[model samples]
Target: MSCHNPAAKIDIPKEAKKIVLAGNPNVGKSVFFNYLTGLYVDVSNFPGTTIDISSGKLNKDVVMDTPGVYGVSSFNDEEKVARDIILYADIILNVVDAVHLERDLFLTQQIIDMGKPVVVALNMMDDVQRNGLKIDIELLSKKLGVEIIPTTAIKNEGLDKIKDALYRAKPGNRIEEVKEIIDKIINKVDTESEALLLAEEDENIIDRHNIKDFNGQREYIYKLRRYRVDEIVDSTVFEVNQNASFKTKLSRMMLKPLTGIPILFVTLYIMYQAIGVFMAQTVVGITEEVIMGKYYYNFIMNILGSLLKDSSLIGQLLIGEFGLITMVPIYILGLLLPLVVGFYFFLSILEDSGYLPRIAALVDRALTSLGLNGRAIIPMILGFGCVTMATITTRLLGSKREKFIATMLLGLAIPCSAQLGVIMGLIAPLGLKALIIYCLTIFIVFVLTGTLLNKLMPGESSDLLIDIPPLRLPRLSNVLKKTYVKSIMFLKEATPLFIIGGLLITVLQYTGLLDSIASGLSPFTVGFLKLPPEVSQAFIMGIVRRDFGAAGLNDLASQGLLSGPQLITSLVAITLFVPCIAAIMVIFKERSWQESVLIYVGSFIISFLTAGILAQIIM
Candidate 1:
């Protein structure tokens, strides 16, 4: 069956062409896929493979990406999956790391030998220059008999041409011996790709065809492909200089303890000023107070007031304090958009510059003490952006123990960026003491939780395995595009959930469930935490979302209902509160139900318990 057939489990249109992206690992295939297919793509396990394959529609054509593999064979599941995808592809867009052509070209040559139309993206052109190497692009293209486009994917350069070059892609140079063998077997196989695989005596293909599975030429074919790749690389790539570039020197500085620590601190300070201070303070005031609060609120109210009864259920649903239309837009556009956008922009630039990996390397030893390798820091850092996503990312951990420990810490302590934005806005008015106390408290919890889990968990974590990308100057166009795409996507997905949360809160209020729950929790809220019963409402909404809960406290603070001590207590409690519903669901998906429940109950108990103690200390 064709890959687009129902057996492949994809819904490609009948007339649509299939373009499969093939590359080795860490060659920027994903970035290229996103650019070609857009931000939101459908990801699923490819048939029986455990690994996921992502595909998206581009105009009428269906573009899909395969797992990065060295060659098309059944040596591993990744290779097997890529082999199958390549066999059925109408065209192959092979992403070759320009810096690693010595290795990448092996795959390129093998794919070309399969008699497939191929377009090679000579990716990481900037990294090639920084490494002081040059590629004879024209000669390489000639050697492979394919169109090779040089692309600096992160810089958003040369990508536009790849889309255009798809039309010009054609079969590359095939080895004479392989071609002769393929010509003999081509009659028995469904495609040229299969014929090449059959020529190499691929056991899987041989079985599928039920032909003679005893051909002894596999080793010869692989040996021939390697020799050809080496010949092509020798003639087309040159080392212009061996001297270290500025980026090289900087990467060295960033990996060393003395320099990296200070650098990390400066980066953190800049991030805080941009996202926490400037965005939380100045920009929010205009978006939240001036535009949405003063202008939009008034405009909506005027229209709603003249049209419907303010006291009716429909009025309460539409124009109520917790109304979907009124509260949802205001909270999303006015409050969260600027803060997330600023943070994502900063994060994009940081990630593009290749500093995030260095940060991981710098903190690897410290993480080891917590029963995790340095790679754990990546998800922890990502937790600040979205614990839901960071939860999913814990799959990268080598052991269940590390994932459990990391998930526990993230759920209990790390505040998402939007929540942090609200926290900063609330605490800024109360001075440095409140800020320090919050940070110190959360930090202590994070350390203690990880340490305790380390001691209690049964297994050991895997050693740090990481690939460090070359450091380079971030491109403005790339950063801005990332920021804009990510921010808009966040809002688009979040708006419906926010509306549901607001509507649920409104219904609970009208039906008295909200008040009743508050009443039940009043003893702890009022007596222990020294907070009002209304604070219970924040915790209730927190189960829906961490930021919504923080925004609830923001509502209380604006109404002058919380004193400095009470505000600090509430913020700390909510900060340590259960992660949002999405994160909880993801945690459940990533781990057993027993582990998920433990995290959930543990978070709630610890959040309140910590706040109660802090309430006495500060209140």
Candidate 2:
């Protein structure tokens, strides 16, 4: 149940106590977690975009996020993790959905039964009021025997009160007896027994000699929770009309077969044109060429080049054609800059608007047939933006099997916006038929490969359990804030990889390793794919960034070396090759080393084979 493995406990930091934000799922726990931790929250959206926990620093103190659970005794994986955090957390923030106060109170009562010091955040108070619900906060606070603060997180309200409450928080005398009883029950059990009890909610416990105790303690706790939740709902919650609203209708419309697929196609079309064409081409062209190429590039190359000229190796590594100085600005500014920024903007709106879940539902059936759950679409959709980010998201997939399949498909089939853009730009000069072939080939590979892997891989499939938030226009301020945070995170993570990649390439070229490698790969290059031997180094550059190889192809296209058929083959190969190094690093982070290596090799072979086949057919 605990996502973190149990190792010998580290000593708590001398300066600060670790406070954990705990709550039921979809109760705005993450939003409160974000607010409490401010800019320090580590935003990890797993592959399915399902249950993720984040940690943030609150002053000198640390705030941990536990996945939402229904109750401490619940069978769900998240529930077990919640109970552990409750037991271990120095302080707890029990977040409750104000609109569904009764349902939220079930988990609250579980935490209360454990006797941890907790403050109740009555989140979504604005929504509660809009539905004609009124809660006597003071009375409810007294009943729960904890401080209750009303918060409308989307509006950024009530955060100050939470901070103030944290400062003043102390263990309540009211729950002392209950806490002592639970602690006694817990401490008496062995680690294995404890885990079993937590996961199975087993009421019976046997000692070392097999003496069983059925003292009615666990049942009594269960009865108490039922009574408390019923009492709270009758007293606090007031749902008006109680029927599906307009937003609910919209949600249904977005998932229905008749309408959903059309909407999805339209959305993808807009996304492609918006990010791939306008951002990557129009905006990036101006930034990279007109401004950077005209001024910054000349200044850096002239100054740095002159200084290091005495040592050719140092000069080339620093400022030559393959140098970090030469490649960083071009790769970052030309290829990544526009697409990354644009994607952040796009992602902000989708996440905030809460339409992603509906889209998942719509595409669920199709994806499932390929041996992937419908929720896997989230990362696949994200792959169009950047494979690195998408690969990191694979953490959301419930099973390792699913993660492996998704990662492999992503590396082999999904082209990031930069590569897609360049392909579209290059192939369009030929005709739309070239574009169709390009797309159809990739889709066929994605499906056939995923299906085969699904059959070959051994593991249980993850049945998708996803939250479908009410459809609403995203708040502009929230969108901007999320976009800004993600953009900063991307730049920080990627810049170093870009610089190092460039420097490595420069070194390889200077040492003659590049030529040797190219010569070795020439058979596959010239004979099968019918590409020039120099294109081997291009493939090497692509390991650093997919778009870097794409830019390499653009250079070949400029020199008129590749014919129409060869151009398409090269494009397909580069696109399907292992996603850039950033993506590979994320694969390592999300999956095991064995799984990541499998994906890397599988993608490498698949890309080359597909390219070779395409060359034969087209030529």
Each prediction's Cα lDDT score?
Answer: 0.86, 0.74
Stretches of candidate 2 exceeding 4 Å from the true structure? 1-69, 73-246, 302-311
Using Cα atoms with residue i matched to residue i, what is each candidate's TM-score against the true structure? 0.66, 0.66
Query: Which 10-residue window in model 2 sums to the lowest lDDT?
Result: 1-10
Over the stretch 429-505, how does candidate 2's per-residue lDDT look in tens digits? 77778878888898889999988987887765665656667678999999989878877777787788878888888
Cα TM-score of candidate 1 = 0.66
> Compared with the true structure, what per-residue lDDT tens digits does model 1 show for residues 1-619?
4432222666678898899999998889998899999965888877776878899977889899998887888889888888888888888999989987877887888888888899999999988877777789999899889999999999989999999898799999988888887888788768878888887777778778778635647766876877787799899988665665877667767888999999999999899988899999999999989999889999998887789776777888888888876888888999989888988899889888889888998999898888998998888888888888789899998778898999999899999988999999999889988888988988888888888999988977666646677788899999999889878877876788788888888888888998899899999899999998899999898888999899999999999999998999899999999978888988999999999999999999999999999999997
Best by lDDT: 1
